[model samples]
Target: MSKRREIETLEIEKIVEKLCLKSNIILRADVLRALKKVCKNETKNPVAKKMLQLLVDNAKIAEKEKIAICQDTGLVTVFIEMGDKVIIRGGNIVDAVNKGVKEAYQKGYFRKSIVIDPIYRVNTGTNTPCIVHLDVVKGNKCKIIVMPKGFGSENKGRISMMNPTSSIETIEQFCVETVKIAGPDACPPYVIGIGLGGTMDFAALLSKRALLRPINLYNSSKHIAKMEKSLEKKINDLKIGIMGLGGISTVLGVNIETASTHIAGLPVAVSISCHALRSASAEI
Candidate 1:
């Protein structure tokens, strides 16, 4: 029999706390690089070029000062990959993550954006009950990824059910329209994550997960990668510009992840993320 590897709640909390704090303060290197490239190519629209430069400058300031990149800070989202042989001891995993989020928000001075109830709209104050997604895999090591998602771009996400026979052009058109509608509200110079196939909820989840992928990486499948590149060009053609000021550098990257779905439906979800694009990962 394989030996069970014990993982303590305290250990999880410490890792999550640090991940949250670091993710907020430090912009991912790939995203920073993409922003710089966009700035270089945004000469057609002086306003957009200037805005991209400001964003790059902002990231540098945030990193140097060790301060939260955006005032929103955002609600915490944790993705956990657990090994089958791993046994979480000492306390519950959810509790540990929540504790870590609370501590990070307090220590990092991140804004508490979560509400206790959707309708009542009362503030949770501590930002408890972080959104957690867990996937059990075959291994001995546990991996955790934390993404602090601001609603500015998140609220612009959209999901739709399409006929299974929908052509790629249809999918492309839908994505472009979504970006056009999002306009300034979603924040331009966005990272667009496209999730195709799966059920409605799963498609949405896949879109969100796609955002966690490295900005410079493309899907392994040649077809998917081509589609991603095509979508990026189409979205940029919308001329949304930086912060929707009408310029050439509208989208920084486009990522797509698909899963097998029912023959009857093709569910597509688009998740938009702003320039901050904050996330961090650790393995234990």
Candidate 2:
């Protein structure tokens, strides 16, 4: 028989802190590659080419200075993978994760963007109460990923309780409409994430989770992968380009994630990220 593994809450918090700092400072490799790819593809559009290169350059400076790639710094989002055989000590998982975020913000001196109340509009100060999602899978180790999700592209997200009878083109059109609406405001050379199942809230959550996937990869489903490629082409064809400047490359990549849901309900959500798609992960 296999023995259960014990994981200290302190260990989780420390790793979370390090990941928060690291992700905010460093641009993910896949995102960087996409930016460079667009630089090459947008040779005809001088403005687009220059803007895309600037983004790549900005990433380099942020890494060297050990500062946030984007000033918004974003509301912290944590995704945790807890192994079924593991047990935690010291404190609860959610509290530990939030503690790590608080420590990281203090240590790194990142911006405090979170507000306790939507209407009151008071700063949380500590950047506590970050978004956390935990999952139990078959394993013995806990894995954590921290993503600093800026509100720029996040606000551009859209959701629809798609009719169960909707066609593929209908879904594709909704995703395209979202990008056109986002335009330059959300920042361009964007990474588009789509979630295609589950309930209203879950679909939105899945959409954000979809953004965590590397832009270079495709979903496991054959048809889904095809749809991603199709949706990407459709979005770029809009010529929203880099920051709505008009170029061959509008979106860097499109990723779609799906989950099972009730037969009577069909839901879809779209999430997006700017060129500075910042995230980092650690396994313990």
Candidate 3:
């Protein structure tokens, strides 16, 4: 039998709190590099180029000053990959994560954006009860990824159920139309995550998970990589520009994740993440 790895709940909480602070304040290096590259390449649209530059500058300032890149520090979303042989000690995992989130928001002075009730609408204040997705894998370690997702871009995400026979062209069109509809609301210079071939909820979750990938990486499948490139170009062609001001550098990247689905259904989801693109990961 494989040796079991025991992890203290406090250790998880410490890592989660650190991840929240780091992800919010420091934009991922890949994302910052992409924005700078866009600024350099967008020669025709000076306004958009300037906006892109500003974004880069903002990231630099946030990192240097140890402050959030955007005022909306965002709701916490944690993805946990647990090895089958790993054991949690000390306390419940979910409670530990929530405690970590509360500490991060309070100590780091991040905006508490969670609401206790969706309809009645009262602020959670502590940003507790973060969205957690747990997956069991084959290792003896735990890996955690934290994504601070702002609502502006998140609200624009969409999912659709299409016939299994739907062509790539149809899927491409749907993605483009989604971006067009999102427009400025999602904050241009977006990172688009496309999830395909899963159940409706799974598709949406996959799309959100796709955003956690590095901006520089492409889908591993050759066909999917090609489609990702094509989608990126099409999205930039929309001229949404920086903050939707009209330019050639609208989308920084397009990532696609796929899973097996029922023969009768082809569910697709598009998750739009703004330029902030804040996420960080660690393994323990």
Candidate 4:
């Protein structure tokens, strides 16, 4: 028989509060590395190289000063992998997570961007009611990842329900078109997340999940991996450059996540994340 562990909700809240601040202030390691790598070897284009260097420097200053990497601060989204053998005590998990976010935004002096209603356009003020996705797993430990997603790139995401028989070129076109449409507004030198083979909503969620993957990692399946590389090549070829100044390094990477789907439906979602690509994870 396996041993079960009891954890306090306060512990979860504290961990999440720390993660919220960390994610907002510190750029992900992989993202920072990619920026430096490209900036070092990037083409002779003066504008592109200068922009990439500024981005790299900005990341450094933010972490050193313990300040927000971007003014948006972002909408907090938490993804949790909870073990079934674990028991929660003291309080409800959802409330605990919200309290954590509220505390972080207030303490970190991060901007609160969530609104009470889309129509009313009033700020929630607490950045509470953060979006949470939880999955029950096998172990006793709970893994949590906090992603501060900025709306500039979020608004540019696109989803399409296409024929299952859609050709590779067709799919590539849809994905590439999204980046092209985003232009400079969504922030270039972006990380592109492509989700394929699921229902409409799941596909969109998968795209967001794809952004969580490290920049250099490729999909495991060989065919899928090839497609990812091809798409990455195609996007950089757009020469959107850094902030769309026109250079060879438009995107840092492209990630594709897939799920089993019904035969008639081929749902595809494209999510574009800007250079910051902030996320932090910890297990408890």
Candidate 5:
């Protein structure tokens, strides 16, 4: 039998806590830089151009003050890639993740956005539990990524089951239309993540995961790459601008990931991410 390497659950918990605190409470440097670049690229509209600059300035202020970029911090989400050879010795994986979330939110002075109960709606004092997705892969090390999803863009995501006969153009149309309708509500200069195939729920999950891909990389398949580029151009053409005032910096990137699907339907999902795009990953 392969020896199971012991994993320290406390370390995992501590890491998660830090991730939670940093993700929402801090304006990540990468995302901040991206916004500045997009801002500098706009030349046509004065309002949008000014909004972009203001966003940059605001980010600077948040950094200096060590404050959250947005009031709606977000719900905690952790994605874990567990090693097959690892054995968690201290506690349950989910418990460790939850404890980490609680400590991080509390220590970082972030607002607890989680409500304990539905209908009655009581706030969970600390963001005790995160929405965790775990995958056990063939490896001896573990990787964790935490993403705090803001309500604005999360609310705008959509899923659809189209006839399997639906053409690629149809898929593109749905993506573009969804963003168009989202307008400024979902926030502009957004990252659009599209997941096609699988069942409806799986498609939505994949779309969310696709948002984790780096902004600079294009799809691997040439055909898919071209489609992504075309869709990106269309989204930018909407001229939603920095904060939807109208400019050339609306959509920063479009990403699509897929899996084989059933024969009768085309399962599609779109996840919209706002300008902040706060996320971070770590390996141990």
Candidate 6:
């Protein structure tokens, strides 16, 4: 590979499409194991446990057959960490992404769940024009992380700006309440990502980005890890159970990340991920 890589536009297009298909079709193994582990340890009700088993089985079928587990393929989201020295050659990067999305959905036999106009509600059938976020980093390569944000969980995302005087207890309560309100709608045995101290949208994006971190890893910051553990306990206490059948496992894990903010306000955002938690990353 050339240090001055010339990644073609068509190549990007193809990659996006393939990624969408893969992400929609197969639940990642890490997500599957985490769900099983959380359910086994936290859930108590027999009925919920049974439902969880069904979910596990469903995931297996989706993986084996290469089919989407849910009809909603989700809004395509890309997180790009671009190295400072890397220059993309060939076509427009955005168009390359859209082209990739188009090809993948078509070739992979996945549903195209995008609408052309929000109000008119015209279906774009190809699932083109994915949501892409790019960041420039210090290296000479690019790392692309793809996460398909399904509406079920995405709809339940929450954001708030509290006074500087707001206590951590208040933030904790917000996290728990977000899950309770979402109930079974967002799917259970889910991962919770919390972000603090940013503007509204940035905070929300941070929360979602935090979910991209590996489930097995703990936050590097001791204070953040402690808060994550505490929130996880409180959320599990909700007893929303597996698939909201009402049991002990309301949440699988809570991961919190924070950043400094203005003295006048404390911003918080919470995002949830369903059991599938489909995500993939590659560096090139």
lDDT of 4 by residue, 35-113 (tens): 9999998867988899899999999899999999998988988999999999999989989999999999999999999
Candidate 4: 10-residue stretch with minimal lDDT: 241-250
RMSD of each: 1.2, 1.0, 0.9, 0.9, 1.7, 2.1
Q: Candidate order by lDDT, highest to lowest?
A: 4, 1, 3, 2, 5, 6
State every prediction's TM-score relative to the real structure: 0.97, 0.97, 0.98, 0.98, 0.94, 0.93
Each model's number of backbone clashes?
A: 0, 0, 0, 0, 1, 4
Residue-wise C-alpha lDDT for candidate 2, range 140-253, written one tens digit per residue:
889998988899988999999988899999999999999988988998888988999999999998888888899999999999999999998999899988768898777889
> For candidate 2, what is the total of clashing residue pairs?
0
- Write down the worst ten-residue block by lDDT for model 3: 240-249
Residues 1-284, candidate 3: write the lDDT tens digits: 66899999999999999999999999999998998998999998887878889898999899998888998888888999999999999999988988988998888878988899999989989987799999999979999999999999999999999999999999999999999999888777999998998799999999998898887999999999999999999988898888777978789999999999998999999999998899998899
Off by over 4 Å in 2: none
lDDT of 5 by residue, 8-119 (tens): 9998998887777677656666567778888888877888889889888877777778787777678877899998998887889899999988887777677788888768
What would the TM-score be for candidate 3 when compared with the true structure?
0.98
Q: After superposition, how far is residue 256 of candidate 3 from its true place, in Å?
A: 0.3
Candidate 2 has an lDDT of 0.90
The lDDT per prediction is 0.91, 0.90, 0.91, 0.92, 0.85, 0.80
lDDT of 3 at 241: 85
Clash count, predicted structure 1: 0
For candidate 6, write residues 10-73 as lDDT tens digits.
6566666666777888887777787677557644577887777787788889888888877777
Ten-residue region with minimum lDDT total, candidate 6: 1-10
| lDDT, candidate 1, 1-284, per-residue tens | 55679999899999999999999999999999999998998777787788899999999899898889999888888999999999999989999999999999999888999999999999989977799999998877799999999999888999999999999999999998989888877667899988999999999989988999997999999999999999999988888888778877789899999999998999999999988898999999
The TM-score measured for candidate 6 stands at 0.93
Q: Please give the TM-score that candidate 4 achieves against the real structure.
A: 0.98
Write out the backbone clash pairs for model 5: 189-250
Candidate 5 stretches greater than 4 Å from native = 1-3, 25-30
